[model samples]
Target: MKTTLQRIGMILFMTGFVFSVCAQEMEVTGTVYDAHDKSPLVGVTVQVKGTQNGTVTDVNGRYRIKVEKGNTLSFSYIGYLVQEIKVNKLHLDVYLKPDKVALEEVVVVAFGTQKKNAVAGSVMRVADQSYYLPSVIFPYPREVNTEEYEAFKENRFLSTIQHPLSTFSLDVDGASYSNIRRMINQGQMPSKDVVRVEEIVNYFSYDYPQPSDGYPVRIVTETAVCPWNKKHNMVHIGVKAKEIPSETLPVSNFVFLLDVSGSMFSANKLPLVKASMKLLVNNLRPKDQVAIVTYAGAAGEVLPSTSASDKQKIMEALDNLQAGGSTAGGAGIQLAYKIAEKNLVKGGNNRVILCTDGDFNVGVSSLTELESLIESKRKSGVFLTVLGYGMGNYKDNKLQTLAQKGNGNHAYIDNLQEANKVLVNEFGGTMYAVAKDVKLQVEFNPNFVNAYRLIGYESRLLNDEDFNDDTKDAGELGAGHTVTALYEIVPVGVDVPVGNVDKLKYQQTKNDVSLPKFADSKELLTVKLRYKEPDKDVSRKLEVPVLANRMNLNASQDFNFAMAAAMFGQLLRNSDFKGDAEYSDVIRLARKGLGNDPNGYRHEFIRLVEAVEQLEK
Candidate 1:
């Protein structure tokens, strides 16, 4: 981390307002400025929520808009943060702060197939503390083939009696699996960091029943003998997000936040983004509104918010984009969110679809600043979907941070087919939020099991207390999405699962105060889930207790295939708990679970296992 951030600031100059309410409407007026130095900010946009009425701030950082008393007013500016206020009979003044991640004076070369002129402006890079400019100009640069990932250790087995509670956020991200598949297809061995087992397991949907109850997500579980570790018991836990029909889903407000940086000048980057976004655009209902924001040298709104019925306007905006300039992700993010907030949808699905390689080389380019900005903006009720493109030079770490911090999920679009799978086939799940901050906590009964290990989800683990904390952020579940987790349990009487740790010395014994209660409970474990409604702040909780039934010789088809995917993950990562796990066994389990194979995703999983087998050979 740097010692001090260069307090790049923004300011709002406020003049008092009269109760001047005529027919419940008033002329809302305000000015935006640079907070650090009080310099007037030009081109700031002030808009009334849920309406097309808006105006831009002049060079004096002043603007006025007439809106209703209860309407929300959005103040937005490039390279700065956004401020929103509801109209009341009070003083009208807001001091906007700087988006530290604001893009500086960055430049990029715009090259065509034929020779093109070099960019003229000097590109800026950040230095710690006080600033000094030693201008360095270089020619067209060579592409850097590098990628970043979130590093996490595998979950380990814990004694049921010692640590009876297991808690983690339920995640539906499938980026890791498709990303690994891309590497395998290209004959590259996916490193450990590149493999997230939960994502791999969640790449395919299971036939988990939807919520029949009033809740938005339903929890289902099936018990089966562990495929890799035979003596161990495996439990497949599935949480299915309620599916809202296309017509039933709230009208959407979308902002396409695209990265057109120099790094994105590849076949799989900007071009692919345009194509992928078109698929989503075609799926939007006529009532939905779409806007385009692109960031490179500086962030700008390429297309104003237009109704989806005008498909040609939206399509042309995406088609006209060309990749260039240094990454100004901060500016782009703020602008996109600003647009989404300006066109706020009451009880509707509002989202920002960010297409990027996640590389930010210039313009307030610190990850911490970007994260802080995103966390603050999520309160506006707009969801986020991060579509990562390109391979080498990919910043998965940044994508992960932006998505998890916001009400969002991340997906890597390596090819057009994967793009179709995410944006088209699963449009409902990809674009609509059925539930947010969904978390699961499991309590293992000492009487039913000796020890248990949760497969994958190392990054999504929450503190045991977080399950009940409404303020804690968890995973966001989209409409019709299913999040599955597997736990390998060692029944009380069975030999300790392979790679066993020493018996947990909980310090208390059979005569201890807690021991008698463990012996009294007949249930195996209880799965509790907590989630917040899309429009509410309070959380709702649901739980289902499983009895200590014997392990089944036959399991649900979905359970079988999910376990197969889990086994494949263990083998690929060479997990410590992978007892007797082999590629052949993974293939067999996958084959058994290929019930209907609706989308042939199971077949793809089997092929991935074979690819890994060949790699090992």
Candidate 2:
């Protein structure tokens, strides 16, 4: 028996050796490129066709991987056609064509307008202009669709291709706008994720630093006649952050509105949320207060508001929380807000920091209802901030609306680093609102420019009359955060839409310049801002004039950065007026304008753009 066993082992060993020798390792190296422009593609996936072995292209669109020589290498990415090639060559350059007509052609630009065919470029020296939380991506198996479940059982399915209809709710409120309403009503939801509400809402930093203009702290405003209802006025406000401050700020009242539903049970869902929250807790100052609110099949305040000063207590509350059951987010929200209201410290920052996967199915399930609820609650002076977590079944649209109406900031915490960025480094600014109900409106002189479109912020646009209505809520300014807005202006000669009124011969045109000679050209755009100190009821207005000189798109860092960001957003949204914008063109423009690399956020933008290009190939 021993001899036979030894003979069998030797035979098996030799067979393994023979197979190993026969299957030589294939060294696959390649450069990913944009099929449309023949540009290099970064972050494109290069995988062994059938196996899990895969690698992504670097910033320069270069990738190297080792696979069995006979295995085929599959090159795949979103927004681009997939390509498969046998591992026969050591060097390969794969060109991915952009799916021009693919629903992926949309961009979430200024004001969250998901326009298709918008042309814009990537900003240079910037971090990811847009990023979805990791939880939103790797959803749990239980959250998988019927088809996906079948594939899971097979245990051989490739990436689960996201359909437009499957994640339709993740985009901007489909029922909010007329066009989207039309599409949704017809049951023809686009399959591509063009304008994700979370990305659009999180794109701009809010205006912070109460009394500073050097940075983007100050909010800018202007008044105009409302197009929808001429009887009412339209108030346009721009939120700007003054400067990134260096201070150990005030105490905080934080109620964590977490979702521990069955959807978040996956390793990347609930587990990641727990780990991420710990990172945030570790950064809290002793003066700050923390509370835990968990919701699943039922809602409960697992930890009453505790002082950040009590580290052990806070940590234990967080540690004790677990995930299970369905989501009763509405109930949890009510409870969390109640806790916040109860622990409301006058003058001290009172905020309910909602941490969730954003999948609210039970209790006030409708987005509008949720938004209306938040709107009423903000009047309590307890601000709301949303920290998103988990993936599959994520409801970004709902959370975005909730935060917007709640008069707070929205952040997608995809990684621990981002958590630190929001919770630790910018703790004061993130938790405390120096200015509330911030609004901006800019009235441009018809002479300086033919036409202009405010990039992004489509959803935040206010009615002209809303400017003076203190009751009309807007955005809140955090401490030392910068808010950027871009205006694509057509020079005087451009055939831009001059007002849509009748061309009356009596209405003075070029001749009016002489009549209003006293009017300074510098005041071409009048910027008005309204805000109430965090604790005050009566709002105050601040006025600034945007001189024609400040319109130097090439000279000012503010102009350059704003333009770059706007262009990038427009490109993503596929705006109708994103004129002649190209990825490489925008990259060049931004590289020149990005004056410094203090935060390395700018550099990250460049990498992300390159990554997107690769993905689009």
Candidate 3:
């Protein structure tokens, strides 16, 4: 009888345990807001404590997630204090305070700001000083200095008579545009160095006709009145890469070279990277493979190359990552390349996706050293995609150099929305390269155009001789990628002083060289493009001549929008060439030319311009 009673008690206990377990697993919903302003915080990360399962706040700052009643939910934003709430109730609202300590401890610098503790001699005491020091203390501003940018000299107008051929590698990176938007939204103007005109102009998608022919790329050219300078005409050159369907794309072998160093401990750095990687992993196909390689003080492969079919396993590995040690970026690069090459898919998309804050402190940290390392790895037929995160002490120059040398594209991820745009919506273009070693050479007709200046390719400018050299490495064009270049041209009859060069008394006044009759007729310039197949070493050349037909600035929405973006960049950089280009003009042109902004990127850009104008006022 006693044994029977004990069995009944055990049965009841087991049933209760099952009920408890089921009760604990419930759906939790919440809204996150700013403590001071009570405003909804968009893109705030809400994750289950000690787990990778998380969801970001929607436009209204509302989030829903399934979690155990006993588990905790962590709410984190870039500049806000992290908040944790016990999941005891079904609905929980969280108000996160701004992290005042971080804001007060930052020191503003010319190029960028640095943390007070990071700056040398920033906290020196009076005891260490030999001379009297005056101390003036003021209330710390809420702003934190987190932006880092490199200053570049603006391109000046070149006389076609002196230099007729303009050569440059194509650029498809769009990081600068997003980064500038972030600054403008924060009610601050981005530093001059952070504004790359080419990146801004190329950020938007253009309606260039795709190559229906056997060629891998198509070139389109148009000319219109320059928006910035009415006296000068703007030449628009667009390159459209052939679009390839995702299913038909070659199998992918991707190595995620993640930086989990101590510097990446911020909410926006390592945590955001993991979130971004999760988005990418979810988008992977069954035929694709991924490997996780991390660097922190030392480099090691955390997850071996695994098929994308096992997404849960990959996500588990990503969730287990924790940031701590110093960065060994160079070692990490070497190991990642080694793994990628080992599992390389022949005739497939092989690439390394580097997610970091660009803070390389340990071995092989210099920009030149990192460039050499990446350049060496590029020869292995593996491309790179650099996704920069965070801001304080960001090595923008270093990251740009590495991406350029690695034959890859670069982007800055400021939020989950950007991650989705880059890793999810544009996955094919971000991963698969349609053509490699793409270079552009424009030969201006000395008769139709007296002088011309190519804008916003200073870093990519190549020597005229380098155009014909097959061994020279240039930029890579991804599937469905569109690249645009703008040239401010001076007509032959325009009387513009071309930098006032001294007349060479030793040479003939005008060489008796015969000029092509078409040069004086309608041919304004010749556009020549050289690109190689993804797997080939030799390049194929395409050439087209642009006529001297000039149209009104309102010729087409594409033309107007392109020129507006270029003018915006010039205004941001305070280029001397930007004559009478006001913020009002930019807003007017951008709003009118915002064609079918399905993704709303163009509309967002227009809003940013308006915001900047308000801030300037």
Candidate 4:
């Protein structure tokens, strides 16, 4: 009895000791303000010195962090001098001073109805001029030119007899389109390397029917006379993914991976990023959950998983982010994916929505390393959403690589209006996926075609055999998304400027071996598509034979619009295959294709062409 009583006393003593330690760790609440303007500064990083534990100032410049006794806290913000203070009491306030030299390094130019001559007599070195209403114009006065894009050669027409099968992945990403749009609107011609013709054409939705055969995606095919060259025909392939109602959409487990590097301090960068994030948060369902992870020279999680119902808290987290330090993109991604996996919502939408300028100067910055890291994470069934921002030093190649490897989508947010389009208006299509690893393989028939070339998708091309391999990663189809692909065809009797393949000893013709099942059919081409259910490993197949259609003078508006976009992209890149493509032709096709454009996006495209025409003159 005496020993039992002594054991109970020891247990009580240990419990009391634990309670005392917990009591000593107090919640420190504080507000950060700019010393110059005396305004509440949003996105101030409030962190415990020498540790990863930190929090960001919210929309109101308020931050709350639990700190142990005698722990020092560091406050940092972009273009602001850092301040460190010891945590003593429950309440604390911080005032940060702006660093003038740092401010000068980041040029702030006028935008959205502002004059070309902006702050501090900075005449934005524009290549052309016509301010787009949705504006994000900043001059790289310091470095002058730093934007990066992967260079790729245009696809060439192949002899139908030698190369009958053309396989490539399907993509719904619109980053290339918007990024170029920003360049053109900023009075600069988008470099050829940055112009992705497929992305440009697929940016706009076509009047294709959704899935009705119990599958998540449907295939629609059409034919029209090539707008650029009447002698050459164009085949239009449209894939429309089924749409789910917003209310019935799967619960989302989102981790907002943000780059808070010094490069993102410009108005159109970090500030725009915060605005864009808020737009997405507004569309989140009550049952959805969100967390935030930030990276500068190092990576840290600023917010833990919190219910979307607590939207105010989420917005606060976004507001508290400010940019400073070098970019650690790889570390940020790793930390974000880890947190997302930890809070995985089984059988639901699990994603890491990374918003960055795509600059990675610090640890794990190599493309090969990031690719391997993302490849491993893709097996975890977590989707990725990459949102590119900023211009000077923007890493387009890295962003595209990450998106493709992760089986995710990419978009560029230039302004608040664009943010609304992607995050609010098109919320369902941008955030949720219905089909994963979508790929298309086209077998052109020699009987109907002499030569053929896929209009775009040079970067998405795949080995023909990879179509059957479920392990190969490909682009994903989001809910309510429509992906459009075009093929330039030279009919059997028609001829175009292209090369012929040399006869090979091992080559086996249809007569030498055996004819394909559809070789004798009247089909112009056979399109075989493969896609996996978002949660599955094995893929399902859909095959459709497209019958040849003689050139049509009256093509559908959807086809016309897509053709216009294709022609515009080709002309911009000065593609050798652009035969007779002209700005006037782009304007004409775009005008004719402006059917039921409630959002006025088509009309805007027409105006953009006019602007480019003026630039050429």
Q: Largest lDDT belongs to which candidate?
A: 4
Q: List residue ranges in candidate 3 displaced over 4 A.
A: 1-42, 45-87, 90-148, 509-521, 550-553
Comparing 1 with 2 on TM-score, the higher-scoring candidate is 1
lDDT of 1 by residue, 1-617 (tens): 24233232211111112333334677777667777788766545566765535545543566555678888887655346777788885346556677543222222222111111222221111111122211111111234346777778999888876688999988899998888876664334566778889998998998888898698999998898888777788988999998888888889999999999978875457766877787788888899999999999899999999999999999889867888789989889999999999999998889999999999877656779878988998998999999998765788888888888898899998765677789878888999998899999999988788889999999888989999999889889988999999999988788764454454596655436665464587788999999998999999999999878745789988998899899888877878888998999999988989998766778988887886575455
What is the C-alpha lDDT profile of model 4 across 1-617, one tens digit per residue?
99999999999999999878755888899899999988998656677777655656755687778789678998876558778898888999999998664333333232432332233334233322322222122222234346678889999998887789999999898888888777665555676888899999987878799799799999988887888888888998999999898899889999999999988876567867886787688878899999999999999999999999999999888877878999999999999999999999999999999999888999888789888889989988789999998776788889998999997789987656667788877877888899999999999988888889998899999999999999888889988999999999999888745764555588666434465544466789999999999889999999998887545668899999999999999998889989888899999989889999987788878988886775565
Model 3 lDDT, full chain set: 0.82
lDDT of 3 by residue, 1-617 (tens): 99999999999999999889866789888889999999988778787877656667754677777898888898876557778888888999999998776444543333344465465534321112222111111111122344455557878888887788999999999988988775554334666788899999988889889896799999998888888777778898999999888789899999999999977776567777887898888878999999999999999999999999999999989878888899999999999999999999999999999999888889999888998899899999899999998754566787899889998999988777788888877887788999999999999987788888888988899999999999898999999989999999988789764667465677743333553343345678899999999899999999998876655545578878888899899988878888899999998898878887899888888877876665454
Residue pairs with clashing backbones, model 3: 297-326
Instruction: Provide the TM-score for each candidate, comma-separated.
Output: 0.75, 0.64, 0.82, 0.78
Point out the higher-scoring one by TM-score: 1 or 3: 3
Ranking, TM-score, top scorer first: 3, 4, 1, 2
Q: After superposing candidate 4 on the true structure, give the runs of residues whose Cα lies further than 4 Å from its correct spot.
A: 1-142, 501-518, 549-551
Clashes of each: 3, 54, 1, 4
Task: Look at candidate 3 and tell me the lDDT of residue 285.
Answer: 92
lDDT of 4 at 85: 94
Question: Which candidate tops TM-score?
Answer: 3
> What are the Cα lDDT values of the candidates?
0.78, 0.57, 0.82, 0.82
